[model samples]
Target chain A: MIEKIFVGSKKYWFWVFSLMALVGIGLCFYLEQFQYGLGITGMSRDVSWGLYIGQFTFFVGVAASAVMVVLPYYLHNHKAFGRITILGEFLAIASVVVCLLFILVDLGQPARFLNIILYPSPNSVMFWDMIALNGYLFLNLLIGWTNLSAEYKGLSHPAWLKPFIYISIPWAISIHTVTAFIYAGLPGRHFWLTAIMAARFLASAFSSGPALLVLLALIMRRFSKFDPGKEAIFGLSKIITYAMIANVFFLGLELFTCFYSGIPAHCHSFEYLYGGGRLTMIMWLSALLACLSLILLINPKTRNNTGWLTLSCCSVFASLWIEKGFGLVVGGFIPNPLGKITEYWPSLPEVFIALGVWAIGLLILTGLYKIAAEVKSQESNAA
Target chain B: MNRRDFLKIAGVGMVSTIFEPVLPYEIKPSKKRLALLIDITKPFDIKACLDACNKAHNIPEIEDPKHKIKWIWPERFSDVFSEQIDMPKEITIPVLCNHCENPPCVRVCPTKATFKRKDGIVMMDYHRCIGCRFCMAACPYGARSFNWIDPKPFIKGSNPKFPTRTKGVVEKCNFCAERLDKRESPACVEPSNGSLIFGYLSEMKDLISNRYCLRRKPDLGTSPSVYYLI
Candidate 1:
């Protein structure tokens, strides 16, 4: 089976090489960033994190939310998700790698990261976040590989892997919740200070995570023989619907609490996210796209339509990305405590560093999936 | 439940109870407990505080204007609680480090460089820091400042009274530890014209009780050191 993978046609090779080239381009950009500090990016004294940290914050939820689909399918005795669960796990791996790399790029002293492990502070939410993320990453890798190998070998997986898989389900939720505490625990940053932040993070991550899986499932079907089937896509989309509506509801709840009472601290982050103030452009764009995507996604007819579903997912992904990634952290700092509006925009070099980190994720994903495909092919040939 | 099970449970319960007793007074320790000054009423000026601190510490002109090592800027207290707010809370309190019992900045620090002193002052050992600035992110006060460009030359030209910071390290109000070692008050503490109060924890509380309106960010739980006369 693995033999067929190496014996594959030129197109497979083309995709592989294209990924490498993009990675190369991203590396060149990373070098420039290293030569200069974050000043090269759009980050200002007020806004410390630009695209790098924003993307990191947003995608970590995507990575951690993988457990949502994995839990019921693997642990609760649902075999229906057998086909796509592998894909979702792999996506989790890809997202986790990207999240770590983004954190690396965002650090003022990337090399000093060993200090995080050596000097762990139990009281800090960030310490828990690091533990959870690294634990989840290895947990998925160990189990996903063993299970896939067992499938290829036509044997029952080792029982030990089952416990880790079960643990990962709840562990995934822990990763994102801990990340939210990194913000909510802060005293002055109004946008992230809300008690509802962790709940909101989970709600949004579930929807967007499943939405991303749905989009990938469709792409897999079109581009290759790997059609994960309509059942898988539909099942994932249903999950998306439930989670999306919950996300929107939580969002509404956040707005109502902030606006009706009109506490100025609570109001500012929303204002920056919605339609007014310095970040209005990003806020309005995200809101518009999110609303439009919800319209398409809510209708079962349109939701199931492959083209519209993909479009809707991408829109929602971008919208949520903008809201959490681009807008939240920067907006939280605007006018600052000094009542001064300090603006930040990402520079080209920083974008390149981000692009590079994302490329690395894609390359890793492609390689892992490629190996899976090869091994699966060999097993079928043997049969 | 049997006696053995009850004993096990009782032992565990006793252990947990011994760890943390939030009870009002379960034998308050005898160590000289230090507290930060939190003044809620009156305007704050950096200069008067610096001068008084200089006189008290016997380290006059400790801050070199050329180095500009310390900064004291007026901030809207309203913004402290809400980001969307553009105005102050009408009555602004002079603010500084709350010297949090469980400081978040210390938690997120990748390098373990930033630490809170036993006396309720958040201080930094710059030598140990690798300039990661993650502590800056962990700080909710927007209190920590980083030296983006090299600060060595800038500080060198000043009074040479204070050493300049290097590029990449995070720095903030030290609560004048140098002065504390000399048995003097912080530069920020000396200039208070009854508007600000600097004293031990119990004394400050007595002062706060006597004030017209004494309040703090009830939600933060950090219990600040600087006190105001409002």
Candidate 2:
């Protein structure tokens, strides 16, 4: 099965090498950051977390979103999703890898990364988050590989794998929930102290994760013999439609709560995000894209059209990426506890490091998907 | 490889595990809950106190505001007390670690690198810190600062006795715990000329009982050890 990835077309090798080049460049910048300290990044005393943390938060959602397809296929026995579930699990592996790397690059003392496990503090939310993330990654790898290998061998998956599959269902929810607790539990950050933060994270994740999957499935159809199935693609678009609506509705609820209460501390962050602050443009653009995508997705006529469906999926993915990846994490720090506004913009090294991480994820996805496609093609040819 | 050898090792391990908790270790219970009282009404020399803290802690003098590390500094009154509706006369107020009883930083630290000591001071183990910056986010008062760069070059004159921090660790004031252990006054308190008072909270109650004192964001339930006499 592993040999399938190595024996690829010329185009595949070119793509693989391109990603390797990016990983190499990112490693060079990371070494510089390691020597100098986190000062190479745009983070300041006020906004201590910047691009790395924001990316970590966003990718956690992508990793957790694998549950959507897994639940329908395994629990409900939805036959259409059987072909696509492997793709979700594979995407999760790639996303979780990206997430862990972002955390590593963001650390000031990357060498001491083991200290979190060495002297574990159960009282801390971060301790639980570390456990949840690593556990989810292991679960996905075990479940995805076992199922894929069994399918390739033309045998039924082992019955013993049932419990792990069920456990992964709830475990996926826990990963995103713990990630939300990291920000939601804080006392002074008015913007992130909302009770609905976990719900918001789940909604955005459900929408965005599958939206990216739809794009990936379409890409696979173009380049490989694996057609993740038309029914499965449409099923995912339906999930994205409702989830994006819920995400937008949650944003509205936050707005009403902040303005109706008329509390300055509660209102200040919104003001920073929507009211003439540095993030105002980006925030508005995200809102616009969300609305645009929702309009396109809700209409059955447009959704049935592959071109419009692709457009809306791209919109959903981009909108949520900006809102969660850029706005939510950074907005929480604005108007710091002292009522001082210090904006953060990622440095060149920081952007390249992030891109490098994304490239690594893509490379992993390419290999895993290549194997999946080869097995599917072989099975179809025999049939 | 033999049964006797395995039995010997198991017995020793079992004995050590059983007795380790009961060992007669020197556990020093703190006799005082220390507090700092600042008399805002008095003319305070902010620069002198800042200078003393910088020299005492071996803090660097980095020109870049983004990467600057500070243990103690002065903030404007309006900014510090932004929740106040009526605008008071603007003045400089010294701010540092509150050493809160219910410290959010300690609760959020994954590695227990930042912890509250027995004497009500929040201590940071620089060596143990993974430089995650989670403490910086959890601290409501902006009390924590991260070593964004190697601080050695920026130190005008490094204090040999105090350890200079490496890049990527979080640090803040420990209420001069080292000085307290030596029975000497904090470097900042000594030069404050009665403007800053450092003593056990119980002993200083009489001094603050009659005056109108305030603690930063008391509503947050952090129970700050620092008090300002307005």
Q: What TM-scores do the predictions have?
A: 0.82, 0.95
lDDT of 1 by residue, B1-230 (tens): 99999999999999888644222111223234455554554555645765554333223122422112334434556645443233444544444455556566765664557776656667776656655566666565656666544554333224344445554566777767776778876666566664455556765666657764333354556545554344
Q: How well is candidate 1 docked (DockQ)?
A: 0.21
lDDT tens digits, residues A127-246, model 1?
677888898889878877887888877886898887888888888888888888877877767777789888888988988888888887777666655657787787777777777778
Residue A134's lDDT in candidate 2:
91
Stretches off by above 4 angstroms in model 1 are A1-14, A377-383, B1-70, B75-96, B100-102, B107-111, B127-134, B137-140, B153-164, B183-219
Write down the TM-score for model 1: 0.82
- Which digits, one per residue and each the tens of the lDDT, describe model 2 over residues B162-183? 8999999999998888888899
